[model samples]
Target: MNITEVRVKLTEAKKNRLQAFCSITIDNDFVVRDLKIIEGYKGAFVAMPSRKLADKCPKCNSKNHLRSRFCNDCGAKLNDKRALGESGDESKGKFKLYADTAHPINSKCRDEIEQKVLAAYKEESEKAKQPGYKPPAMEVPDLDFDEDNTNS
Candidate 1:
């Protein structure tokens, strides 16, 4: 798949490991947003968009994140070991608290995406250093309601 466009938005927080947020357009038809550029120990890397994993509370059946100490909808205390495996040792059988929403199926595709995104990030970073530079808008198109239906 050809990545036709890439957009990078540099993060404002300097202390954070997160460097920027990016979006990629594939073949000028599909768009994937929320890809992150993070500073890892080895260097910068691309992280695909992901969502927090959650489970229902035993008492209220309300959903809460795996790391939550208490339920959000109900005031019941959540099980800290809910995310653990049968061994009850996270190191032995670690459970992922986040799952990728969109990712490359193979290493080649992943590398390609990483290279392109990192290059765009470097370019954007340089642009930010200029005297009068404005960051590109990375707003997602609103698909929930149509303009004609809003007034009705």
Candidate 2:
């Protein structure tokens, strides 16, 4: 059977009975009663029928996993498989890389992400190599900003 819609109400902090009272409308309009919300070691998750994700592999049209890349049933690569720059070659397929830069966050997202990743990597690498190294004391620099330099 297939579930059409799922509505869950948040309990204060029931722990086990987490997503208390979920209303799931199943196939033929008959709702399945009281599906439990389970809390795992990692996090909370609600498991439903596989049909909720996909019935067949989109690429090969084989009924393997509802959500999977290559079909385990037929071993065919699914439809949405992508190769690097495969779309631009007319001999292959049309590929489009769409970017929406109007949003403020998109403008600096790549730079900000790269800076954070590099900082984390540097810190971890330094710690990993400093098993017997002595730590050097660092001095704080004066950070006063000059405001009069722009008055040309």
Candidate 3:
């Protein structure tokens, strides 16, 4: 898939690992939002959008994040080892508490996305150092059709 456009919004907190938020337009048709530019040990990398993994509390039947020590609703003690089993290979530090909402199926696609996103992030960062730089708007325009405004 061709990356038609990439937009980056730099974060204010310089100390944080999260450097920026980005969105990409694929083939000028599909849009994916909330991709992150994170400062890893090696360098900056793009992280796909993901959501916290959660499971229901046995006691209260309330949903709780996999890493949660206690249930949000019932406050019952949760099994800390629960996520360890669900996520594969904790010994290798591959334990996951979040699941990617969208991701590339292969390494080539992933590399393409990462390269494009990081380049945009670097460009945005340089722009921020300019005299009067404004962050790019990350909002996607509404595409919904209104029946009243439609032409017959």
Each prediction's RMSD to truth: 9.3, 23.0, 10.7
Give all TM-scores, in the order shown.
0.88, 0.27, 0.86
Off by over 4 Å in 1: 140-152
lDDT score for residue 49 of model 3: 75
Residue 137's lDDT in candidate 2 = 32
Candidate 2: lDDT of 37?
A: 37
Candidate 1 colliding pairs = none
Worst 10 residues of 3 by lDDT: 143-152
lDDT of 3 by residue, 1-73 (tens): 9999999988777887777878999999999997777777788888787777789999999999887899999
Which candidate ranks first by lDDT, i.e. highest? 1
- In model 1, what lDDT does residue 4 have? 95
Clashing pairs in 2: 59-78, 59-79, 87-95
> Candidate 3, clashing residue pairs?
none
Clashes of each: 0, 3, 0
Give the higher-lDDT candidate: 1 or 2.
1
- Candidate 2: global Cα-lDDT? 0.38
For each candidate, the alpha-carbon lDDT, in order, equals 0.80, 0.38, 0.79
Q: Who is ahead in lDDT, 1 or 3? A: 1
